[model samples]
Target chain A: MIPTISVFEHSPDRGQGLARDMSVRWAFEEVGQAYEVRQVSLSAIKQPAHQALHPFGQIPTYEEGDLALFESGAIVLHIAEHHVGLLPADPNGRARAIMWMFAALSTVEPPIVQREIAMYMEHDKTWYEKRLPLLEDGIRVRLHQLSSRLGKADWLEEAFSAGDLMMVQVLRRLKTSSVLGEFPNLCAYITRGEARPAFKRAYDAQLAAFIGKPPKQAN
Target chain B: MIPTISVFEHSPDRGQGLARDMSVRWAFEEVGQAYEVRQVSLSAIKQPAHQALHPFGQIPTYEEGDLALFESGAIVLHIAEHHVGLLPADPNGRARAIMWMFAALSTVEPPIVQREIAMYMEHDKTWYEKRLPLLEDGIRVRLHQLSSRLGKADWLEEAFSAGDLMMVQVLRRLKTSSVLGEFPNLCAYITRGEARPAFKRAYDAQLAAFIGKPPKQAN
Candidate 1:
């Protein structure tokens, strides 16, 4: 049986494909793998059923046969391990690619996520406006270092591996912000990632799922 | 030649073994692998030399032969991949073990680090005190969910694989805070992990390095 992944019933990203599941979807497309989707509502995510799938009650848990996994980065890695296209065949190349995956999730994403949390949850607080700059500055530090490292390279490595997919997904969070614009190369890098056929397929699928959803009728 | 990991010449954790390097060291100890240490000063970390090793210029870059990798999670996984004790022999179990490693770093550690950032960086800001509880609450939500999942279990999984090693390291950051006390099971889990001979050996070695460091000469 093919893998099935759980996603938000109505994604908070409004079909922009910013949710964690986007990476999983993108990985599947790159690998020519077929998968099913299981949609869970925000409230339903915390219920026992969802919690059993993901202890943290977050969406984008992957299941195939008896092996189920949580964490988008891990799921992507698993798909990359089982699939041919997502990772380099060489041992050292594979290690570095996986290293970039950790860098994307562990190092780059946290600050961006912190910024998002402030925008979403802390905006009404007295500290909202004051804290926003600090959060943005944090994101800038990571982006600048990443931009410097990227230079003229099209991807983080020799070819577009899962690392780039993960980094591109993480960087996509900054597309709306002026901060990402400061790094011209990074901006262009994101464009290249979004331009990929696999990424387009995944993005279109997630967006279609969101738009296909019927708006809730008034009770 | 044994792998040599770069660590902070003066660890920000002040020898508490909370630095990112701790995971790499602990992983080495767990697998009974010996390693060398290369200490870099704070300013040195941002220089091109360190940058070449880790684009982000973070500590805990592992180097052996031609393979050099960064991100503590990735380094630990690399070690686990080559060694036997850190990962289960089965494919699915190994997959889940790596999943928890991502969960610890990507999910669990971010909130805790956010709280820490505020404590150290934003304490003087006008919103510091006011914003503190919001961050703590964010952490509490994760801890509560984690506590529930960890109820009566010694680790996140059946055996002490790399997953537990990573999770315990992430959770240990909370030990000095009041928040971790709310969940006795988690506290016990940390205790169990820290009690391991491997963990103690790694902790002692890192701690010794910190204490052994000579104070900077006065101008």
Candidate 2:
């Protein structure tokens, strides 16, 4: 049976693809998996029913048969593990890919998320100006290290795996910020990941869902 | 040859077990894996040598043979993947377990970490009081959903896996707050996880490392 994942009925981003479900959709499309999306409203997400699917009342949650899963990273990993395209076949390489996945979520994403919180919620606070640079510096440290490691390589690791998929998604959050441009290679890498046919499909699909239309085919 | 993992030479947490390396130490102890800890000071962490292993200069990078990996979640997953006890044999069940691992880091840990930042760094801010509750409520929502699903179950799933291991660690951050007590089942569940011999061994080992002494055996 095709699995169903939850997404926002009307995204807060207004079709910007910042919604967390975009990653899951992209993963599914990359793996060529057919799935359904159950659009959830903001109020319904906090209710018990939605909470059962997602402990945090967040999108997206994956359900198939008796199996239910939350956390986009987990959902993506599940898709990657079950499907052929997302991971490497070599044991060590596979483990490294998984490591990159964690690095994206745990190390890299935290600072970027912090920056978002500061921007959206704490903009008026007295400490906002003081704290913004600290957060950005933290993000820059990670990005600098990532860029150096990535060097001239197209991806973070050997080939494009789930790790690259996740890292690209995390880096995309910095697209509007000057932090990304600080590292030229990393910026190009993000563009490369974005240029993927599957990613284009996923991005367009999420954008379509937000705007209430069907996804446009990539040119 | 025995594998080696990276850790802080002198942790900023001052042995509070807040450092990321604690999780790696705990995971190693859980599997009875004999490993060595290579200490990296904050300065050295930023140096090229350390950057080679961990692009972000974070602790708890793992190396076995020629393979080097970073990110505590990824390192723990790697250790769990190679060992028998951390993951289940069933494909779907294994996927669920991995999902929980991601949920712990991505979904559950973020709010708690935010609360920490607000309390510690932003305490003097005028909006601290107003913002603190939002973050706490965010955390509480996740805990509530988790508790309801747990529903008197001993573990998050049927058997104790790496998912539980990571979840328990993440939830432990909320111990000082009464937030966890708001949900009885989750409190009991964390207690059960803490009472495990493997967990106890790991905890004590970490505590010992911090205290600069051997681990004490619990009665």
Candidate 3:
């Protein structure tokens, strides 16, 4: 049976892939997994039914048979584990790929989230002028470390696996900032991920969902 | 040969297990893996040597043989994958558990971190009062969903696995807010995890490291 996942009925980002569900959709598409997207309103998400599947009442909950899971990382990881394309075959390489997955969510995403919160919620605050730089610096520090590790390598580690997929998604959030432009190689690297046929399919799929329509008729 | 993990020589949290390294230590203690801690000062963390291991220049990088990894979730997940006690034998069950690990870091921890930033960095802002409540509500919404799902269950899933270890650690960050206390079951759930001998061992070890001495010359 095809697994089912949840997504916003009307995304807050209009048509952007910034919502968490985008990652899951991208992962599913990459793995050739036929999945269903259950549209969830923000209000319905907090209701008991949704909470049962997702303890945190967030989007991108996955269900296959008796197993129900939440968290986009977990959902993507599950897809990667069961499918062939998302991870490496060698044992040590596989473990390293999983590490990159964790690094993307835990180490890299936090500061990006902080930047969003600051921009959205703290713009009017008296300290906004002063705190913005610090937050930016915090993000730069992580990026610098990442850029250094990434160096001239195409991906965070060898072989673009699910880890790189997730990392690219996280870094894409910084596209509006100058951080990505600061490192020429990282910018090209992100561009490469975005240019993937699978990523394009996922991005267009999410954008379609937001517009309340299917993909535009192909030329 | 024993695995080696990285930690702060002098933690900002002083003796608290709030540092990311604590999660790695807890995983080691749970799986009965003997490990060594390599302490790095804040200055050295920014240096090239440390940056090679952790691009983010954060504590709790893991190394076994030639492999090096950063990100606490990645490190802990790595340890869990190799050690039997942290994951389940069932494929579906194991995947669900891993999902909880991501949920802890990605969904749950973000708002809690926001609360911290608000409290510390923006305390003097004119809009602090307005912003704090919104952040708190954001956290509460997640907590309420989590509490309802937990609904008197002993753990997030079937049994206590690495997922629960990470979840408990994430929730513990909100202990000071009284938001967790609002959910009686969740509060008790965190306490139960903390009371475990393995958790205590890890906590004490981190505490000892921070206090610049052994665990208070245990009674």
Question: lDDT tens string, model 2, A102-151?
Answer: 98998789889989978997799776787788789878988888888899
Tell me model 3's lDDT, rounded to 2 decimals: 0.83
lDDT: worst 10-residue window of model 1 chain B = B210-219
Candidate 1 per-residue lDDT, tens place, B1-219, comes to 788889999898899999999999899988888888888999999999999998998899999999999999999999999988999999999999999999999999999999999999999999888888888888999989989988897778788999999999999999778998988888999999999988888888888879885321101
Q: Could you say which candidate leads in lDDT? A: 1
Please name the candidate that would achieve the greatest DockQ relative to the true structure. Answer: 1
| List of chain A TM-scores, every candidate | 0.96, 0.96, 0.95
Candidate 1 runs further than 4 Å off: A213-219, B213-219
**lDDT string, candidate 1, A38-79, tens digits:** 889999999999999899999899999999999999999999
Ranking by TM-score: 1, 3, 2
lDDT at A118 for candidate 2?
81
DockQ of 1: 0.81
> C-alpha displacement of A41 in model 2, angstroms?
2.2
lDDT by residue for model 3 (B87-197), tens: 999998899788888888988888898899779877887768877888899899888777877787899778998889998999988878977778999889988999988
**Which CAPRI level is candidate 3?**
medium
